[model samples]
Target chain A: MATMHTPQIVETNHPGHWKKSVKTGLKYIPLLILIFFFTFPLVFMIVSSFKRDNLQIFADLRSMRAFLPVGELTLDNYRAVFINSNFPRYLMNSIGLTIVTILLAMLVNSMAAYALSRLKWRGQKLALSVIIATLIIPGQAVIMPMLLLVASLPAISFEGGVIALTQGWLDTYYVQVIPFVTSAFSIFLFYQFFQDIPKELDEAALVDGANRFQIYYRIIVPMSGPVFASVAILTFISSWNAFLWPIMTVQSDNLRPVMVGLLFFFQRDVQWAEVMAYTTMITIPVLLFFFLFQSAFVKSVATSGLKG
Target chain B: MTAPTVPIEKSEGKPKKERQIIVGLLMAAPAFLLMILFLVTPFFGGIYFSFTNQRLIAATETEVVGFRNYTRLLSLSVLPLEPVVDETTGQPVLDETGELTYPRSREITRDEENYPQYAGLTEWFTFDVGDTRYVVLAGDPNFYRSIVNNFFFAIVVIPLQTGLALLLALLVNQGLRGQTFFRTMYFAPVVTSMVVVSIVWKFLYDPNNGLINEMISTLTFGAVGPINWLGNPSIAMWAIIIMSVWQGVGMQMMLFIAGLQQIPGSLYEATSIDGANTWQEFRHITLPGLRNVMVFIFLTITIAAFQLFDQVFVMTNGGPDNATTTTVFHMYREGFREQKIGYASAIAVIFFLIIVGINLIQRYAVKEKEA
Candidate 1:
């Protein structure tokens, strides 16, 4: 009988020995300084949000000015962002759009991907390959054509014939949010993940007389929470951050999402402080999403096709 | 490759091929139809519209201009390259450094060369081209300046972003104390809305009261030496490049860290036994391991840098003197803002071919070298 080999791990990988085992801080020291530099702007933004809105704020344009006590901090900036502006509307718009898009996209992609990956049919591989190939094409090159698609949808004229089909759809949420809700990356991610699932599970389910849809839903999706979470994170973040397309699509003031609102947050006369406050407000959801799913996100991104 | 004369006789009491097809189509209908209508059609339509005068109207309008736009774009004279010209003495003085060097506001008079220079001097200096007089537009020079600036931005920013990202990734992946926390912080910018970042940085870069100028003045002198960070023709593009690197490096870092994690510890241990120091270890062990990841990072960043629009859109809007207009931004402005959709499409087609060609050559060269 052959003996089984045990995997060996080194003790030096431990954090306690990391500093000691490595004498050249020169190597790691530069990295530390860079991380600090890269992260400082965000830190400064969060901290400054707490500062008093007195002359000290404006006068002390120098970040190194006489330190104001933290106790003197006020909620005035957040107050200004929320109360004085249409920030609440904008917030709702962004959150609603992100949530809807993520759910719709994930459901659609996972179903199609499961069908494509798990179901056996001729040329299925070729179809999946073609879909994946489209991802390499930059979204910008296709934006105008997309604009044309949205524009071609008959106008919202109830009196008209063809335009009547889209009578209320012209400037509705569907036009603004639906165009971008489909993602090739999501489909590809789900396909790769679905393919990795042992075929035995599907076969077992089928042996029990479960239909294809039932197998996908009851067997596959229940086991795919982590991938789902990661996809959800990416989809939400990307959708929330989406700017150009939304700008091109949404015309109604009430319908304008956070990105569009942020675009025109400051009118011709821009106030820098107010803009920062607005920026902080807009990024809150994204920041929260990343904080919650940083690990899962990294893994999902690692698995997502590395091309772009 | 298989012969296609197979018939599926039902074995188990389940749905047949036709039945499966119906169910499959029903299941996949929403996504497939949406993808085809929105994605596939736009692609074909983009190519078609690139050849047609299909700008102002919807898809119904069909006017084919037969390569005229392409010919015009191909024959374009690069907008002249001069920074703001001094009105009194037509000499140009602009900062080429990628740092914050431009002076705040109108501190410079005619005596000081840093005062804005105008490129509209061609009216004064007539060219004898077929005995006709020509007047140059003042803004045209800025366009060419931006194109050059765009190159500088790409060259400098991509390497810097990549290098720092690699360093951070190595550190975090070393299983350092509180690694996840630091990793999270590093990548926070990646997930954050770039528009918000740009807006916030706009305030931060404000020449008058931006936190950046404030910090600099306090650290050095008390004077808030405001830099025209995203304005002034000089350092505008570089400023955008700095912010872009800050927001983007995390992604590259993630890739590098992943790459680093894949390298077997045995190789490093073996190298260490041979007395390879930190630099040597990186150059030999770590670098060789990271070559594939590095190529991916390099090309991805290069392409992303070329498609630089969001920063220019949010921060500069093609700028104090059109100094930050990268190719994509130029294309957008031409097609959408100027309503010269045909001309813009030509630019896009040319750009598409260039990107594809470059990508193929890179892959081919890398493959050959690997072989």
Candidate 2:
């Protein structure tokens, strides 16, 4: 009777453990589905970029082979993207634009935020309010008038070792960078971060005979790394992905950023693999940046969402 | 001691305050000047331009148009269409397809002497009430369609995206292993440029050789598809919406995750003690906790939906039949493509008001809920 009872207990326990495992597996099904749904297109893009040509890319789409790097892969698509098009120029243009914009935006917006949060002066409140009020005006609203304004504005340029004054900012690199540098949103983000920092640090620096600029440089900026990181990431993403303004303002292929460049490439009848390669090339830099600053990016987006 | 120190501090602070003011002014100058130059100037110029006949190239002298652009954009009229009569039977005529035979909409719309209000109005659509078929016409039917499309996009995408984000947040918030991996995977597209996403999806949306159709075909054993995703007018906007949602849902998901983390675990513990199940706890605790986040996400997504342009421009170019033309896309087409800067500025003004209206309504609704 004891032996029979022991066997019965073991038999019941085995089934109960199996049932719990099954339930756990079932709970993960939704997550698995979502992961697949979100990642499949991207995976297909990367995989297809390496495929020999459009024929192989499409042929592989019929099965799970589309997501796998299993076909006759070649460097030809990437070669074509580089050798056959102006992709290299666009890539360099985008890279230079993104780095310059991020640096300038960080410097300009942070200084403004520093003044607003740390210094007490007459008219500061009014200035801050005016800046904040402009936040409601979407970029799309001002774009048309901005085009006209930029078109008639005077620009200084160097031509053949001569300083020449040119009318209109159209089709210029500064046109893209300068207008976006003074972002209200970036200033606000920096202001919020700066305001939370203890003012005692600034006072201590001042007691050490530091001037206002020195206090801001020595005290405020060092303590504000996270916010600076956030601003840089935000600016980098926007400037790198900028489309509407670039497309509207830039007509020269040499001046076009990667986004508008991709549009021009897609508009032309090209092989699917080449398109994929072009997209992959443009996307890798951003993806690498995102991966390195994953937590900061997530935190910035979360904060932005909350504030909105 | 206090009196002496206070006087000494005051004596030292005056010049320091003056110096601080000067420094602050200098520090703030660059950003302020640029804002006034680029943002404030352009904003007012846009409003000013809307009242004048301002072209990009200005082929003629600019003149004040006095609300002509606004009226042209907003004008709509509805006129009842009388059915053609059969002379012999005195009965209303029917077409061979068995629909009511009415006089062509153009004939009535163009008869300016009798129907001056309807002049310049093109037929938007027709509707029937009782036995009367009323033709709805607009001065700029394309603009009206763009507005409708904008609303359709916002209405569909806001709820759909918010719900999906919430669902994803809940799934990832469970403290499961490899949650970071899943989160990173989901966020890959958000980091990618919209242009690249649009181009990639354009290929994926190809009617014949697209992966989406191939997958569907394989799954169903080839019963459906090779369906024209972007080439069909009716399905084009929907295709864009799906792609847009897919591209953007990750950011909202991150927000939802942050909101989820803010909810105290003790509430769930307490609810579970009170015999609350998973659904009960979610409804009572999670939803209420995420109320502020939900309102924020909803407003942002709605604003973004109205600003839809890149995808439409890249994927469909507001076609198969202008089915996907959004307000911003329309503005771009008019302002840049057609060089009708004045008309585009009017669209811009209207777009700005709509955004403000959305923000105000959300604020009012949220306040009401809180009360």
Candidate 3:
């Protein structure tokens, strides 16, 4: 009787284990569905980018075959994007502009933030308040007047190997890069990060005969790598993805960024596959950057939310 | 040693203070200068321009119009339309389609001497109150439409995006295996440029031979349709909203995830010990814990919704009968495309005040909730 009871208990418990595993699997169903929904368009884009033509793209749209890299896959769409358009130039222009903006923004905003948070000065509070107050003014509000102002602002240009004074800053790299370098948001981010560092480090460096500049350079900056990384990534993404300003300011295709270039490409009577290829080309660099610095990217955005 | 040191310090202190002041000024100068040049100046310029007839390329000197631009933008009138009466029968006339017939709205709006306030006004919409049909007139009907579109977008998008973001945050925060992969996949759209996303979605929304319609048709066994997503005025704005939410929900989700992590785990443990279920834990703990994050996200999303231009410009160009026109898009059209700089500046000024008003109200509401 004892042996029969023990076997009965084991038999009941075995199915219970199977049921628990099934319940756990059920929990993942929603997550998997969402992942597929969110990632499908992008995956479809990349997969279709390799197809031979719009005919193939649409033909495969009704089946799982659309997502799979099959049925006459080719790099011709990518080749056509480069050969038929100014995409390569636009890509290069965007990269250069983004790099320059990030570097300048990091340097200038960090210095301002250091002055506000670490150094002793008169009116620092007022200055900081003024800067942060500007955050409420959305860029759209100023864009019209900004266009007029930049159009009339003085700039120097090299013409035929001779330096000449120019009246307008329009249709130039300077118009795109210079006005965006000194961001109030970047300064605020740096100020918040710098405020948490102990002031004793500055005092320690100062007592060792280091100047304020030296303290900022040696102690504060080196200690604030995370914040700097955050600012750089934030600036990189914004500058890379900039559209309204560049479209208004840049007219020359040689100076236009990838966003504007994509717009022009879309407006033309081009094939759908080429459009996908163009978009994929522009998106890869930013995605690669995001994946490489995933944690920093997430942290920056999260902190930005807490800024309010 | 003390006396010598004290004397030396007294001599150095004043100059040191001056030097520090100078250095601080130097450090802050570049950013301040740029801000003043690009931001402060343009802001004031916009305000000043709004009061004048400042064209982009001024053929004539800009004149101070003295609230004319504002009047043009904000003017409105509502009047009851009298249905046309049949001369022989002494009864209200009806059209062949069996609707009450009234005189054209243009005639009344065009009569400047009697309806001076409605001089430039056009018919925006008409509705009936009992037996009377009232027509809403506007100085700029497109502007009114843009405002309505912006509000409609904000109202729909704020709640939908916030709820979805919270759900996603919760899902990913459950310590599930492959959580990182899930989070990354969800966030992939946020990193892509709005231009690219808009274009990609435009293709998907194609009326014929598009993926979305194909899927819908297949699922319904070909009963539903080849819907013209963007070309249809009624559905165009909704299309834009869906794409915008998809593109943006990830950022808010990341914020919520961070907020979720900040909640103490011990609260949940205590709740579980008291026999609290999943729904109860979420309602009591998760919702309250996310209040601040929700407020922040709501305000930001609302502000962004008001500034909806990129997708409209790319996909619709405020087309399909002006259905998707936004304040920013309208301003861009007036200011840049039409060269009506002063009028657009007026729009910009109003847009700025609205944003400021929103921020103030949000701050007050959040503070009240906390208290």
Candidate 4:
């Protein structure tokens, strides 16, 4: 038995094992090719950003040298993007807006979702259905009137360091943040997650003299970490990536988001390398966020129930 | 088992139910109010504004011009669109009313189409009778053109993106090595802004120095001249479409992969036991399994296609003579750029109706499929 075992082990560990390894590797060739196809644009974007100019990019387009980090690499493009453009301001604006939007959205949507899903109320079914129905209403369809509405809506703002009532929401940070805070999709997500939680827990909490709000605050919200994270990430990504509304509303350079600031590069001369560098910078935060919560993102999107 | 009786706890909780109703309303109030203010109001407001001649910076009084904008967009006429110039000045002739007049005749060999001059020269309706062609231009050619472009974009992008996504999902659904890595790579773009994608693609589509043309030239051994991707009107929309598909296929792929996982392995195993080939198994089992997901994806994609704005806005700006102009792009231009709020509102209303119509159809289809 010992002799047989030794021979079997030796055979399994033999140099001829490469054939089986190669066969296994061959199975992944299609997946690898697809990965390359999918990732090449981004890879090219990063690689080409480090290149000197458009001419260099064109010259290296055909060869393996295009993808390699071998060229007249310089920080000049990055320097130009910062020095000549409002990229920093745009980034700050987006970050601030995204944070506030996500926080408010989480609170508001979760509260609403809790009420709709957990609390017993009159017209609860109707309200939930109405909220869900709004998912089908594409933002493009209502943007025109929304523009008009925002333009005419009253706002409170600071003038000369004093609080003042403003007539319109045009060209302001509040306009960017406020309208997006109460998201129906986020609420729907919360509702779905909250519905899955056991009603017995709520009943038990109630029997212990806990109110609905107490149950929600102490029990439900504490337990619903995954859904909260999902909503927060999705909401943050969306608000960060907001383009059209910001463009329509925000005219000032200071309030512009990174997506809008991207156009600043185009309005001037077309510096391909610099533009690429700028795009990479703008894309990095989203990519990092995605990588960090990749599974959560996939899960949230899978359970999103519907899309816009 | 206890006898049927009102529990003392249940009797005491009567006020609690009332309080619950009040609390629920209070909790849901802010979101409901915001939804009304932001979404529902605008929806009705769009319809209201469509009938009025509301300009952004107009000093004049706003008046409801019933059906004028819609008719302006839809009206058509058959006329010989010939310029009347001064004959003595070696040009065509002017009428007695001092306005340029076309010599209108039924016997004219060539029939030119005409529309409201605001619609541009794009509107044309052609009919041929005994080798005499009659071309009639629609009132708002731009609107019609945008609709055409929207339909074209939808028709091309949906199937291509969905098919590519389905293929990726199917491939990755296999228990392959580095599956998560492949998924992450595929889904990376879904997290990025559409504007970023457009900007990157725009750089790639540049006429002289873009990588796309450069790669194409190298692939063909310099036999083909450098193709003007965005510059050429014929290919600009397709360029945008390709980029959109790239950016969007990820989400659809993820959805499909999730759908695939939900499918019971036992079904496939049973089919294989019956000696079913891969294609046969896929057709009978996989396709049917993914029906709901496919329908969902189809609906969302169709809606997205109609709402194609960000990429077009960033890359083409409805440019190269508006060849890539979509419906939303047109609405944006009319409303924001041109400050024609009322006209744009009409477009928005029509777009809403179309979207509703599509969703209803989708719902009916899903229901029918289940039935």
- Candidate lDDT scores, in order, read 0.70, 0.88, 0.89, 0.83
**Model 3: pairs clashing at backbone N, Cα or C within 3 Å:** none
The per-candidate count of clashes, in order, stands at 8, 0, 0, 2
Instruction: Give model 3's docking category.
Output: medium
List the DockQ of the predictions in order.
Answer: 0.35, 0.53, 0.51, 0.47
**Candidate 1 residue lDDT tens string, B166-264:** 878878887666777778888888877787788778768878767777777767786647677877877887788889988888888888988998999
Which pairs clash (backbone N, Cα, C closer than 3 Å) in model 2? none
Better of 3 and 4 by TM-score: 3
Choose 1 or 3, whichever is better by DockQ. Answer: 3
* Candidate 3 residue-wise lDDT at B360: 96
Q: Which stretches of candidate 3 lie over 4 Å from their true place?
A: A1-16, A305-308, B1-11
The CA root-mean-square deviation of candidate 3, after full C-alpha superposition on the true structure, stands at 4.1
| Best-to-worst ranking by DockQ | 2, 3, 4, 1
Query: Model 3 over residues B182-297: C-alpha lDDT tens digits?
Result: 99889989889999999999999999878888888988999997999999999999999999989889999999998999999999988876767789999999899999899999
lDDT of 1 by residue, A1-308 (tens): 01111111334454476655475555567657766677666665665666665354566555444233344666677777776667789778878888898899889989888878776555667778888887767777767667667766754454534445553344567776676666788888888888889999987987798988898899999988877887887777677777877776677778888877877766632544455567766666567866876788777654442333
Misplaced by over 4 Å in model 1 are A1-32, A52-54, A63-72, A154-164, A167-170, A268-272, A301-308, B1-15, B57-62, B76-150, B221-225
Over the full model, what C-alpha lDDT does candidate 4 score relative to the true structure?
0.83
A88 Cα displacement, candidate 2 (Å): 0.8
Report model 3's chain A TM-score.
0.93
Q: What lDDT tens digits, residue by residue, belong to model 3 across residues A159-274? A: 99999998999999999998898878899989999999998888787789898888888889999999999989888888998899988888888999999999998889459989
